[model samples]
Target: MAMTIALNKAGKRFNRDWIFRNLTFQFESGNSYAIIGSNGSGKSTFLQVISGAYHLNEGHCTWTDGATLPVEKVYRHIAYCAPYLELIEEMTLLEFLEFHQHFKPFVAGMTPKKIIEEIGMQAAAHKRIQQFSSGMKQRAKLAQCIYSDVPVLLLDEPCTNLDRQGIDLYYTLIDQYAKNRLVLVGSNDEVEYKFCTQRLNIMDYKSF
Candidate 1:
């Protein structure tokens, strides 16, 4: 059993309002976690903190295992996707995938061509992201995220802008890709929660 992520007394604040205080948890490898909370419960903020997109205001986030490395070095193993983040509108879908591939050193055999087909974006692969519909753009973004070959994937509201069939695609990918990796999903959808092996409910963090 390997420990993948640990949150040690982690706290964050915006202005005077404390989003979460004294939060502590450990996520083990080979498991999927669902973070359930209401709107503005700091779900996205927490995910960003764990994903190293934002620095913590207090405490620290640490990866307990796997070749003692710096934060940036460690983040090379993390693939993060969120509905709030937008794709590069200026570039075509294929071009954008190539651009992101440069950051991932482990994606040796992985190519955007097969991923495009998997995500049902083969026809739209050459089109500019700006011309894509919301669902199309989401699928393109998802394809990029999965193609990274990162051991950990953090998804925030992953079902956003997805239709019924598109939503099914998300679940299927997670099941296949999450093996032996840590997956964190921040969602309110009950259907999404069913896939998680563990569940964490973040209520009023300020209270504690």
Candidate 2:
């Protein structure tokens, strides 16, 4: 498989101090990776750069070899799930799903009903997001990400608010959906460790 993402001599700084520097990595298609680090490390920053949410301060992040796509174009092929992103409060689960699907062309096998049934959120499908519990909201987010048919996935703390069964649901989806694309997860959960094929640790600037 060709390389999909690359960060060469990458580094980021807030104001006066370096968060991480001289960092390099290459990600290819058809593999899954997990990023683990201490809380203040640059894990989220690195993901944002790879996901094109932030511009690098030095060097550059590149997407190459496979489809000749730029960062945003590559991002279009990605489904990112982060706790900070808020869903539409007024939209029902079904409506919210339709909202997200508007970002790209629809896939043949992806249906909201299937996602609803799989995540066990059928009853809440018609309800507004503001009415959902934390776990329910997490389920809705999970359903949205998986149903989008985007191959590359960046999940930040994927199991938040999920019960044992809900966590199982995440693992099941990873097994089913991560066939041809790359999945990168930022998590410290032991269960997540089991599914990770490789681990990348974000070392703090102090440690470097």
Candidate 3:
């Protein structure tokens, strides 16, 4: 079944300060989109709204397969990764993967061992995440999002701490795993969103 997400006249505000207003867009399966804006321009806020992490202050967001799905069930279809998202610092790579799979299964043919090899962190699989470098932590975060068996992928500042090699690995993973999914990348860098065919500039939707 194809997945679809629609935002109907969506708007969000924080304490009388409007971020964006009357935004409407639809995302369909098998396509990739980039949400672009400067710092403090509501790019992350918009992605959060689409990911079902935040409620729109004045509108609605909907997720659908063949029929409209309930809000509570929408998250099962989404895999989200962001720079500010906290990882379990006390858990080792293998342990974290094991824990994550209990809630969200990996894509077909993916296992913890495979993930470790794919991320090139096999030697550190047993090491706690707090011991990881920024780049390594970013790689781990991206791996979980890219390998999850979900229809929607919401990535905010995906290359936050990645080096050149790490950035290259990210694109390779996207080519191998993100095809046929609803991929939305929130970023200001062109390199981070070059693969996206469609672009949504959050500044264009702002009412303030």
Best by the TM-score measure = 3
Candidate 3 per-residue C-alpha lDDT over 1-208 given as tens digits, one digit per residue, 9 for 90 to 100:
4799998898999989888899889999999999999999999998888888788899889899989998888889998999999889999999999999998999999998899998899999999999999999999899889999999999999999899999999999999998889999999999999999899999998785
What TM-score, over all chains together, does every model reach? 0.91, 0.91, 0.98
Model 2 RMSD in angstroms: 2.1
- Candidate 2 lDDT over 1-208, as tens digits, reads 2448887888887786777777788887688888888876777777777788888778778877555667666667777777776889899998888777788433457776667777889899899999999988988877777656665678888888889998999889888877567778887665764688888887733324
lDDT of 1 by residue, 60-130 (tens): 88875665446776677788888888789999988888888888742446687767777888888899999
Which regions of candidate 2 deviate over 4 angstroms?
Answer: 1-3, 65-67, 105-107, 204-208
Query: Candidate 3: where is the Cα deviation over 4 Å?
Result: none
Global lDDT scores for all candidate models: 0.79, 0.76, 0.92
